[model samples]
Target: MSLLTTLNDDIKTAMKAKDKETLSVLRMLKTAIQNEQIKAGRDLNGEEELTVLSREMKQRRDSLAEFEKAGRDDLADKAKIEITIVEKYMPEQLSEEEIRQIVQAAIDQTGASSAKEFGKVMGAVMPKVKGKAVGNQVNAIVKELLQEN
Candidate 1:
């Protein structure tokens, strides 16, 4: 089934199971996907839906970090729950070591020998790794590797 279809089905399942937290997160994801479709004046394709899922997941991670920093353990736990639910819809995440290797390959492929070409290298690499790795993580690894070279 398509991701959207699966999400809608899961929403019904969550409701039937009385899974309020999962249902809420699923509904939020549904809204985000619908909003994107409205904006584009067309329904989202699989790739576009994955983009929305990734964005939602990223927002939850950021929220979790802020909550932790403020010592709001309750809110942080809530954010973590939402993150876990949202992540169910995301492509499997690449590990740090795996991402670092891919980033290095991208750099080599782009012939980016210095930090000055960071932007160019990133542009080349982001598309290649898009659904597999989070942007900020990939960016940090790229920066560290580029700086070292």
Candidate 2:
């Protein structure tokens, strides 16, 4: 099933199971995804859905960090729970080793020899890594590889 369909089914399951926390998070996810679709002026493709899911997860992580910084462990814990719920829908995150392999391939493909061509190498790599690899992780790997080259 498509991610959207799975989400809808999961929402119903959460509701029926009386999983209040899961239901609330799922509802929020549904709302965010619908908002993204409206913004795009059409239904999102699978790739776009993954993009939205990634963005939501990133936002939760940032919020968790801010909450912890302010000494609000209660709020941070809630955000962490919400992040776990959100992550259920995300594709498997790439490991550092896997990400490095992809970056190396991109460098070879683009013939990128310096940090100055980071964007060029990134453009070549992103299509293959999107949704699987987080942006910061990919960028760090690319930078490290380029610096070593």
Candidate 3:
């Protein structure tokens, strides 16, 4: 099913169950997806939908980090819950080892042997891993691998 359709169904379920936390997150996600559609002047395809979902998850993760760093346990706890809720809609994440392997392959494919070719390696890798991995983690692996080359 389309992400929007799935979100709508989940929203209804959350409402029926009086799941405020889940409902809130679902509403926010629905709104984000809708906004992107409006901006594009059309319905988003699966890849576009995944892009929006990834952005939302990244924002929540960044918020979680900041909250914890600031020692705001209550807010951090909420952010953590929000992250978990958002995660339910994401693709299964790639493990570090899987990501490393992908990055290594990209480097070989692109003939990228130094940090100077970061963009080249990343261009080759991102499309392969897309929603399955976080950019920062992929980036770090690429850098580590390239440095070793």
Candidate 4:
């Protein structure tokens, strides 16, 4: 099912179950999706939907980090919950091993032999791993592999 349709259904389920936290997150996600559609002047495709979801996930993760750094466990816990909720809609994440393999392949394909060619490897790898791996993780792996070359 489309992400919007699934979100709608889950919203209803959350309401029926009186799940306040889940209901709130679902409504927020639905609004985000609608806003993106309006901004684009068309409904989002699957990839676009994934992009929105990933953005939401990233925001929560960043917030979680900030909250933890400031010793605000309460807010950090909330951000963790939000992250978990958003993760339900994301594509299955790639493992580190898988990301390493993909990054290696991209480096080889792009003939990026050194850190100076970081952008070339990233450009090639990002498209293939879009929505499946975190950019930072992939970047670190690329750098580690490149430095070893």
Candidate 5:
């Protein structure tokens, strides 16, 4: 089934199971996807849907960090729950080693030999790694590799 279809089905399941937390998070994800579709004036394809899922996951992660920093354990726990739910819909994340390998390849492809060419390497790499790896993590790896070259 398509991701959207699966999500809708899961919403029904959550409601049936009286899983309030899961139901809430699923509804939020549904709203986000619908908003993206309206903004684009068309239904999202797989990649676009994945983009929406990744955005939702990122928001939860940011909220989790902020909540933890503020010592709001209750809110942090909620954010953690939301994050775990959101992560279920995203693509399996790439490991740091895998990301490092791809960044190295991007550097070679772009012939980027110095930090001065960081943007060029990032532009070449981001599309290939989108949703699979976090941006800052990939950026750090790229910077470390470039500095060594």
Candidate 6:
């Protein structure tokens, strides 16, 4: 099933089971997806859906960090649970080793030999790693590898 279809089914299930936390999260997810569709003036492809889901998860993580920083453990805990719920729809994350390998391949492919070519290497790598690895982590690995080369 498509992620949107799955989310819709889960929303109904949540409503039936009276899972308030999950229901709220699912509703918010549905809203986000719908908003993206409206903004684009078309339905999203699977990749676009993943992008929307990733953005939602990132927002939750930022909220979690800010909540913790303000010593609001109650809100932080809620954000953590919401993140867990959002993560259910994401593809399997790439491991550090896998990400590093991809970065190395991109560097070789682009002939990027220094930090100055970071943008070139990143352009080559980001498409392969998108929605699979953290952007900053992949950038760091690329910088480290380029500097060593």
* TM-score per model over all chains: 0.94, 0.91, 0.97, 0.98, 0.96, 0.93
Candidate 1, residue 118: Cα displacement in angstroms equals 0.9
Candidate 2 deviation (Cα RMSD): 1.5
| Residue pairs with backbone atoms closer than 3 Å in model 2 (clashes) | none
Model 2 / residue 44 / CA error / Å: 1.9
TM-score of 1: 0.94
lDDT by residue for model 2 (1-149), tens? 66778889999999999999999988988888899989999998999998888888889988998999999999999999999999889888889999999999999998999999999999998888887877878999999999999
**All candidates in order of TM-score, best leading:** 4, 3, 5, 1, 6, 2
- Which candidate achieves the best lDDT against the true structure? 3
Give a tens-digit lDDT track for model 4, residues 27-132. 9999999999999999999999999998888888889999999999999999988988999999999999999998899988989889999999999999888888
The TM-score of candidate 4 is 0.98
Measured with C-alpha atoms, the lDDT of residue 68 in candidate 1 is 100
Off by over 4 Å in 4: none
| Candidate scoring better on lDDT of 3 and 5 | 3
lDDT of 5 by residue, 1-149 (tens): 67879899999999999999999999999999999999999989999998998888888888888999999999999999998898888889999999999999999999999999999999999988889988889989999999999
Ten residues in sequence with the least summed lDDT for candidate 6: 129-138
> Which residue window of length 10 is worst by lDDT in model 5?
53-62
Per-model C-alpha RMSD? 1.2, 1.5, 0.8, 0.7, 0.9, 1.2
In model 3, the clashing pairs are none
CA displacement after TM-score superposition, residue 78 of candidate 4 (Å): 0.3
Candidate 5, position 61, lDDT: 85
Ranking by lDDT: 3, 4, 5, 6, 2, 1
| Of 1 and 4, the candidate ranking higher by lDDT | 4
Provide the lDDT at 100 for model 6. 89
lDDT of 3: 0.94
lDDT of each: 0.89, 0.90, 0.94, 0.93, 0.92, 0.91
